[model samples]
Structures are given as C-alpha cells and as structure tokens.
Target: MHHLGVSLIVFACVFCSAVLGMYLHGRLPDHHLNDESMGVVKLTIGLIATLAALVLGLLISSAKSSFDTVNGEVTRDAANVILLDRILAQYGPQTDDLRVLLKQSVARGVQIISSNDRAQIASLHTLDAYKRGETFQRKLQELTPQNDMQRRLQARAAEMADEIFALRELGLLQATGTTPIPLLVTLVLWLCIIFCAFGLFTFPNATVTIALFLGALSTSIAIYMILEMNTPLDGLVRVSLGPMREALTVLGQ
Candidate 1:
C-alpha cells in the first residue's frame, strides 16, 4: 500500500479504537467496573501494546532485511556471471562456446527469480541444459597449452555459477522465514493492538460497543495491509521488479 493511504487507515483505526473504548464502557452489563479495575486493565493493555510494538518492529526490520538480501543476491549473481563472461574471453577459442552458454545460463537464472510463482522455482533445464560452465571445465582439462592461468580463470568462472545459484536459494529462504503468513505474526500483533485499545469496554455501563467494533474493523484492515507488505509476491504490495530489470539491461549491454 502507498504511504498516504496506509497512514490514513492506521490513523482511522486508532482513532476509532479510542472512540470505541468510551462507547463500550456504557454497554458493560452489571460489571460495575470500579476505577481500580479500569486502572488495572489500562496497565495490562499498556503492557500488551508495548510488547506488540516490539514484535512488529522486529518483524518489519526482518522483512526489509530479507528483501534487501534478495536484491543483493540478484546483483551478486549478475556480477558473477558478468565477470565469468569476461574471464572466459581469456581462454581464446575454448571460451567462445562457453561464453554464449554462460550468458544464457545467467539470463535463465534471472528469469527464474523474476517469474514469481509464490512457490519454489521452476525447472530451468530447458535453458542450454544449464551446463555451459561444466562443458567449459571439461574442455579446459584437455587443452595442454601453456595457458594454465587461463584454465584456472575458467575454473573460477565455473565455480562462480554454483555460488550464484546457491545465493539465490539462501535469499529465498531468508525472505520466507522472516515474513511467512503461516507464522501468524501479523495477526498476533494486531490482536494486541486492538485489545489494548478496546480495554475501555471494561466499564459495566455498556456504552462503547459500536465504537469498539468500528475500531476493531479498522485495525483488522491495517493488519491485513501490513501482512500484504510482508508477503509481496502473493499480496497487494509486490516487491519491485525494477532491480531485476536493471540486471537484465546490464546483461544485454
């Protein structure tokens, strides 16, 4: 969600909760809540809110970190591929076929990430059998020219492919670990915030029912939005594809 819209919704939620607490107090039946009980409830809600703040803060931080980690992985993979492409050039004739293969493999890796299925990656064996580097390594072993340095460089390039692929998996794991919906992190945080604000209903007079419900509804919506931001691949807030596009553009250049 955009900043302005999210802000307004959050504001409305809190405001509605404040209004609700006042109304719910009037609707409380026979529970003549003394100031002592109200005070205790207030304190309890305050503590809950404090804990919720801590959890939400940590989750948001972790989500942002995961997103950056993925971005970094993509960039690192691109750099590895590009550097390998350049190093392959030193192999002269042996590198020719491998360079094209490296390019295609890197490009396919890029496509896998960009193609988000909200699940595991698709099989990429269709792209040049995804073994240009392996082929290059085998060919280098047979060439007995005084190009040991070039052979080593080609080996490094081949090593880079594995590193880049592994990094992608690392990033994917981190991203999902931090913001998984199954964890119910968002729902937990929202429950605390709503309960804290609805504490005003503790009064026995029963006057705040409508206000409390409105506040609850609004707060629920806000939580849903936060959840969406946390899971962009399948939610309303999708991770930007700009970085991936830039990687592709650089590869083409």
Candidate 2:
C-alpha cells in the first residue's frame, strides 16, 4: 500500500475511537459509568494493547524481511557479475577485449550501487551495458567449446542476470514501501495523548507511575527503530551491502 493510504487508514481509526469515546462520555450522567466498571475497562485496554503489539511486531518482521531480501539480492548479483567476468577471462586472447568491457561494466555497477540516487545509474547507460554483456557471452560461444566448465559458466551468467533483475525489483519495492516517518510520529503522538486523556478521565485513582511509563516507552522506541530500518538508505538503521563490498574489494579493479 502507498504510505499516504496507510496513513489515512491509521488516522481514520484513531479519529473514530476518539470520537466514540467522547460521545460515550458526553452521553453519560455526570460522565460516570457503573461504579465498578474500572476492572472491565482496564482489561479491555490491556487486551487491545497486547493485540496492537502483536500487529506491530508482524509489521516490523515484514520490514526486516524486505530489507534482507533487497540486501541479499544486491550481494548475490554483484558476486555473479564478478564470476561472469572471471569466466570470460578464461577465453584468453580471443575474449580479452570482451572481458575488459565486462570488467568495466562491473566497476561502473559497483559505483552505481554505492550511489544514493538513480541519476548516476542512468548515466551509466544500463541498457546499452547489458547488451554488451549479452554480446560478450555470445562471442564466448564460438571461442569456448561446450565443455563442462563452459556449461557451468553459462549457467552462472544466466543466474547472475536473474539476480540482477531481482535486485532491481527489490530496490524499487523497498523505495516505495517505506512508511512515512511523519505518519508514524503523528500516529504515536495521538495515541499517547489519547492514553493521557483516558487517564485524566479516571481522575482520583488514576496512576501512570514511572515503571509503567518506562515499559511502554521502551516498546514504542523499539517500533520506532523498525520504522527507521524500513526506510532503506535513510536514517541510522539500514540494510547492509557488505557482501557487495566484499566482492568489489576482491576484484580491486
């Protein structure tokens, strides 16, 4: 779902609850429920909070999954490209020029992945570059006979293409799926205010002692961290491309 759509849904939910609660309070004589209803309300809130935590946990897990998938794809794609470069190198003088081109392609790809914007990638002429790889592989067919090693190399090249496409798709999904930080901030702030209002409505015996506050605060902070990670390349929390860097370091090209 789009971040804006989700934000609207969240806002609607909170707004409905607040309006309903206010309506209930207004309809009551002296704004009081049955004398012994405290236990029920507390139990309901506890259950609701528990369920909210469960849903929030699922959301966090989903974000983590997407982040890992994107990172893993990037790493695998980079490694595959490097392996393809080496396989082409095995053609020696016959494919040396093609190998050089592939090497340059891999280098430029590394530079693009390290970038935070798409402009550099566009300037690299990705489509034209991909055609170069295809041409190199086609040339390899005439140079290297169908030996076991050749077969394996060909399979690896194809796999590399798959990984590259998957990584591109994953990157797009990650960029689009991130929850807007502002929406989160608004959601949590309103919830806290609503909780405070609930406490205020319960005047005489109401207590939000330090210990309870601390526990709730801790959980909120954790969810906030998950939101940060969901944002891909933004903020302190992020998905690592350590494996990509490792391959780049290995080539030293």
Candidate 3:
C-alpha cells in the first residue's frame, strides 16, 4: 500500500478513538468521572505509551539500518563494476569487446534497479543482462594470456563480476523486504488507546480537539516514514544512483 493510504488509516483509527473517549466521558456517571479513577487510567495509558515509544524507536532504527545497508551495497557494486572494467582494460585490446558487454550489462542492471515495476524485476533472472554477462564470461574463458599479469587481471575481473552479480541479487531481495503488518497494527492499536485516554480527561474544547488532531497527524507521519524507509527503492526515500552513474562515466573514458 502507498504511504498516504497507511497514514490515513492511522489517522482515522486514532482520531476515532479520541472521539469515542469524548462520547464516553459525557455519558459516564459523576462518580466515575472523579479525578482518582481518571488518574489510574492515565497511569495505565502512560505505561502503554512508554512501551509504544520504545517499539517505535526500534522500528525506526531497524528501518534506517536496512536503508543504509542497501545503499552501501549499491555503492560497492558500482565500484566493483568499474574495477572489473579497468582490470579487463589491462588484459589488452583483445578484451575490448568484453568491456563493451560489461558496460551494456551494467547499464541494463542500473535501469532494472531504478525501475519499480514488478514485471521487469521478476524477469531479471532471464533477461539480456545474464545473456551479456554469460557472453562476457565466455569471452574471458577464450582469452589466451601471454603473461602472468594478463592471466591475473583476467582472474580478478572474473571475480569482480561475480561479486557485482551477487550484490545485485542481494539488493533485489532487500527491495522486497517490508515491515510486518501485525506489528504495525499493534502499534496503531496502542496509539489509539493512548489517544483515547487523552480525550477522557481533557475538556473537549477547540484547543483540546486541535491538539489531539495534530498529535494524531504527527504520529501517523512517523508511521508513514517507517514504512517508506523499509522499502528503499519504491518510496519517498531512495538510495541515490549517483555511484553507478559515476562508474559508468569513468568506464566510458
């Protein structure tokens, strides 16, 4: 689901709970509305609020970690691609075609990574990317090295290509990872309970209502950020493609 959709749902849930609390307050007996009874409820809600805060903090930390890891992998893969291209260059003019194929595969890989389309990503394993990669490998195998230097360059280039491919696959896996629905639902429920308690004791006036509304909006936005960060590639927060783009520029030279 889109981030806005999730945020709206959260807003509705918490806002409705506050409204319900207001309705209950008006109907409750005078004895039940005493400060002593409300104090106990406030204490219980405070504990729930503390637990919810802890969980939210953890969620944000985990999501940010995942985002950073994926970005690091992207940067590493881009560097590896450029390193392989340079290694191939050292293998002499015979490997020129392989370098061309390397650039083509990298271009395609970057395009696929930048795309959010499921069909394109799903067909990634069977695409021309692997075909070009295999052809490049075959050409590497066909090379007849004249010296230890050429042979070593060829071996290192081959290893670099493998690492780049592995990193790409890992990135794809990370793109599909999401926050658990159950956890989000639980968090929303806890927030609603806390908001309900806020409404129970506070006088229902314009100022109080505005405060509750703003509180719910802020909380919903936090949840939206958590969800957006969890899916690095398809949301508002995305890893930059500058590393790969720069690699391509350097390789062309």
Q: CA RMSD for every model?
A: 6.1, 6.5, 1.9
- Show model 1 residue runs off by greater than 4 Å: 1-24, 29-31, 119-146, 178-193, 196-253
lDDT of 2: 0.56
Please list the residue runs of candidate 2 whose C-alpha ends up more than 4 Å from where it truly belongs after superposition.
Answer: 1-35, 117-159, 171-175, 179-194, 201-220
> Model 3, 1-253: lDDT tens per residue?
6888999999999988998888778888988889899888988998999989998998999898988988999899888888888888878998888888788777876787678655676667676756766777778888999999998987887788778878988887886778888988999999999999888887688898889999999999998988888877766788888899889898845
Worst 10 residues of 2 by lDDT: 203-212
The estimated TM-scores of all candidates read 0.66, 0.60, 0.92
Pick by lDDT: 2 or 3, better one = 3
Model 1 agreement with the true structure over 1-253: per-residue lDDT tens digits:
3433544555555655555555666676545467777677778777776766676566667666655666566567566656656666665666676566556655655566566655434343334444544565565455544577976875676576567656655655554543454444454545545554565545423355555556556555655555555554434555565555555564423
lDDT of 2 by residue, 1-253 (tens): 2333444554444444444454555466762565456556666666656655665676688778877766666666667766766665563455566566556656666666467544664454457755765675565555654588766765665565556555655564564466546745554554544554354344322143333344445545555556655756544555566766666565423
Ranking by TM-score: 3, 1, 2
Clashing pairs in 2: none
Q: All models: lDDT? A: 0.56, 0.56, 0.84
Top candidate (lDDT): 3
Q: By TM-score, who's the top model here?
A: 3
